[model samples]
Target chain A: MKVGFFVGCNTAFNRPDLEKAVRYVFPALGIELDNLEGQSCCPTWGTMPSIDLVGWCALGARNYAIAEEKGVDMITVCSTCHGSLARTAYRMQTSPEVRNKVNELLKEVGREFRGTARIRHAVRYLYKEVGPDEITKLLKHRLDGLTVAIQPGCLSLWPKEVFIDKEEDTFHPKVLRELCEALGVSAPHYKQLLECCGMGGMRSTDMEKSFRLVERKMTSMKKEINPDLIVTGCSSCLIQFDTSQEFLQKKGRIYFEIPVLHYMQVLAICLGAEPKMVTGLSRTPVDNIIKRILQG
Target chain B: MKIFEDLQTTAEIALVKNNLAEEIKELGADKLLQCNQCAKCAATCPLVLAGFPFFNKRIIQAILIGARETLLNDISIWACQSCNRCTDLCPRNVNPYEVILATRRMAVREYALPALAVEGIRSLYDVGHAVYLSESGNPRRKLGLPEKPPTTLSFSNALREVQAIMRKTVLADLGIIPMEESANF
Candidate 1:
């Protein structure tokens, strides 16, 4: 299957390894990724209510327009982009009134959205096209000696219909568990595994709310389930847990020094992909485990 | 502030009279009517488990009885991580997260909530991405990402899809459809 790639802002920059891993594993599994260099950010998290909603819709619609222009299906690495584009496609495809109104607004700017493409996040792409059983067969090594917790940020789930089947419930989404099994790791049960990182739009202004939310997750991880690393699918969750852990430590509630990583990095490890190639580890504290997996 | 003051009260009807009632009925009040308020939803809520005072049953009961005042005035609604744990576990299917979302939406419509609260909503425009980063430099470069070409979306396709839906749904009368593909397809 030929799948087009929409590299989200975070992956393209801080987490380039994710894109690298995608390139590494996807094609090998018979999934061809066509990169549309013109693809833009999902812009859902950047929006503030004070700004016009019509404009956000236009930006999101513009992304779809680019993919349609390429005459290929859209596959986004970022959960937020997937949600934004999916919501835009659904609204535009299902509600002509909204479509017309939005188009009227876009017309003033010379952008038109005909809704020709379908949007799928990378998780869905892997689950649906690659299949877990197929992915399991590709593992180069086992992820033993690792007690990882699965953190599926809100963007990945909730709009449940748009995603792949979870291996478990929203809190214990089986997607990551299945991914872990294929990679040879033990995914222990953890509370709030699918909770929000609390670093949504509020991270900029309301630092306290963001901290409070992160602290809660960290505290729970310490008291409830202690894992060597916290595995995540969302960049924002990576930011909240990996970056925010420093903040929580200052408050004298340091339960653990867990490193958070994108699940793709784990997949790359199983596929024998290098650690340095995966991005977003500058702040992560679990370098040893990752390096151990890579070296072996 | 005053919004929080009015919301901290116990009287539902009185809170509504204080103009704290949102355009949409908030969650947590209908418990007496249909909800047993047994704490099951809260027990399952990711936010609650994460240590926030976020209770799905409380929010549900508040909204079931038209306690718009309390729902509108409360700040917990804003703290929802949108995990939707309550939506999945709600034996009654009350969808407290949606109620909280609606309440927040109403708050956003009437008064300016926190700027970040609206950032997700505003991100559709100004910056191509949702979380506002510096607009001056290349976004990819600023975030330590590899530089890439800017992207463009097809306006016509989305417009057609929206138009088709408008024709089918009740939204047809509003003429909310875009005027032309170039301007409002």
Candidate 2:
């Protein structure tokens, strides 16, 4: 399966290791990754989406057009890009008036909104295309009984109408859990499993309140599941959980630190990619988890 | 006697209809009127629990009744995380998150947006990415990848196209960024 990999701004800049992990895993599994060259930001929710509908859809269409021109669907590791791009595509597809208006706007820039390409988040791609069974067979090592607390991130499961890959039960999502199970890891349930990681535009709006949300989530995970690791499908959530633990600890709000991993990073490690190349830049140490995965 | 007198005074007041709900609907929140004051959105909202004065539930009611001034003067609308939990769970399919976004768009028109929001918009216009960092290339280089990751940052022509699209929209009218004629295509 060939696809255009939309490495969003955050994944490209903030966490290149996650980009490295994607580069490592997909080719190893026989999926070809194309750099959708000259692509811009997903424009994120805070920018064009907040401005006006046409502007939002126009920007989103430009990104979608890049992949559509290549005759392949686009896939992103960031849930924000998946949500923004997919939501915009939904708006353009469902509302002909919106489609015309956005197309008019796109016409100025020499692009069109054909809605030909599909937008898939990385985890959903692995779940749907790669299939957990195939992923399991491809793994050089299993999780070896590691327990993980999963944060699917909000975009992967919200406004179900727009997303092509909506979970069967959005309120109680199973894709992330099943993906982990396939890797031979235990992803136990927690009350705040579907809660926002308080990242995205929220952290920019109010850091204290944002941190409070993560603190509440971490507190719940520490109490209910107390898993060895926190795994998330979104890059922003990965940063939130990885970096916020330090502030929460310094504030004496939490007593323990649980290592965090993006699903691709974990999959890369399980696929026998070198741990240092894929995960050495993590804020919360993964040395122990690396030892555990390597020993098995 | 005093309570009766206060009630009489309250009844003498006029109810203002500012058409804020209609404005929000026109801005793409068509379900703004479907909300029946159900607080299910509030039950799960992080901002509501975080003590923001207006969240999905209250923001809907405020807009329906044309409480335009109250919304414009408040910071709660800008604080939405855009997680869409409210959108996902609302029984009326009101899409409270869209309402919040429309309210934010309304806020932007009046220059009532938060500073961070302005910065975010500015970054998108200036660098073609909302979260561009100058030092981002150092890390990409360390990862054995190109310093620029095939985005608008690497392709100035794509950035110009993005800028051209933004110029034709409300962004130019909002005056958030200068749209000069000299750069016309």
Candidate 3:
């Protein structure tokens, strides 16, 4: 199957490995991955409710419009962008009043929103389409000694109106964990597997509250079980946990230098991509995770 | 602590929000008509599990009666993790998640607690960026930032620019004011 990749602004700028990992894994699964240019932020300003919602909607609609032009299904790596674009599409199609209003606004800039495309996050597309059995068959690397704590951010679940899927029993689905196991690793169990990374407006607005939230979760992860890495499904959470550890350490919180790998990035390493290519060193805690995955 | 029943006048707050959002009036009043106070939402709420005082049924009742003061002051709304566990588990799709986020947005405006919302909004107003990275006159080289922070636009100035666009958009009729103009008041 041919798919159009909506490389979100964060992934393009900061977490390039998420994009690289996707490129590496899908070809193995017999899927042709394509990237489109001029894709912008879905601009989820509505999360604050104080920002201009129309501006956000217009920006997001522009993205969907670009993807629709390609005449292929669009896939996004960022859950935040996926949720925003999906909600905009739903609102535009379902509410004629809203569609007319948004279309009217877009007319001024010569961009009319036709709302013809469907957007899916990479995680959802991978699991539902690729299947656990296919993922198991493709594993070439064995990750025997390593254990992982699965962390999925809020945008991936909840607010069911946008997600439109039956809530899975495991927030961080066993699919990713099972994929890891197929590649040879032990998955750790944790209670609040579905907790927010405090990176939402909470972290950007209130550092103390945000840090306290992450600190609390990290502390729990350390005290409860010492996993070899903290693998996550969201780019925002990766930044919050990966880059914010220094701030957490200054506040006297324990340092959890635990590697945070995107699920595809982990799979890439198992598929034998280079440490730099698979682990994404610049914005990741890659050393130990790459070592563990490769050594096994 | 006052529990809203003790408030002197809730009518004014209700009128302001209702005048802005008709759906608020419906959600605030009509939606709770079938509510039997089963406590199912409260019991299953992720917030309550996290020790937050969010009682889903109680919030619905409070909104129904136009008791904005009580609902605005409650910590239950912010405490919601937005995990939607309660909404999903609810026998009725009471949708506690939507209710809490709406109420919290209203409360942020009502209480003028933009500062309480996060330092980001304030910084976004003061400087172009989201947070207050440094002081106004601090040497740019010392901080290691790329350059000096952007100029500080007055809160009102920033609000005016955002409001101008919101006024013409579909969002204008949504009843959310976008920003609390006189938060100090």
> Which is the leading candidate under lDDT?
2
- Which pairs in model 2 have colliding backbones? none
Q: Cα deviation in Å at residue A115, candidate 3?
A: 5.1
Estimate TM-scores for all models: 0.71, 0.94, 0.70
Worst 10 residues of 3 chain B by lDDT: B145-154
By DockQ, rank the candidates, best first: 2, 1, 3
Instruction: Return the number of clashes found in candidate 2.
Output: 0
lDDT of each: 0.58, 0.85, 0.58
Docking level for model 2:
medium
Tens digits of lDDT, candidate 1, B80-176: 5555556566665555555555555555555535645544333323223343344323643443434542332233343343333223322223332
Query: Model 1: per-residue lDDT, tens digit, A1-296?
Result: 78778876665545555667677667767778787654556654333212233444555676676677788788766666766676567657766865787777556545578977778767756876777788877777667777777776676776564343333455446776676666666777766555567765445545676677677677777667777677787766776787877767777767457887777767776777666656434475667877767654
Native contacts retained, all candidates in order: 0.26, 0.76, 0.06
Q: Model 1 chain B — which ten-residue stretch has the worst lDDT? A: B176-185
Kindly provide the TM-score of model 1 when superposed on the true structure, using C-alpha atoms. 0.71
**Which runs in model 2 stand beyond 4 Å of their true positions?**
B1-16, B180-185
lDDT minimum window of 10 residues, candidate 3 chain A: A44-53
**Model 2 chain B: which ten-residue window has the lowest total lDDT?**
B7-16
DockQ of 1: 0.18
TM-score of chain B of 3: 0.49
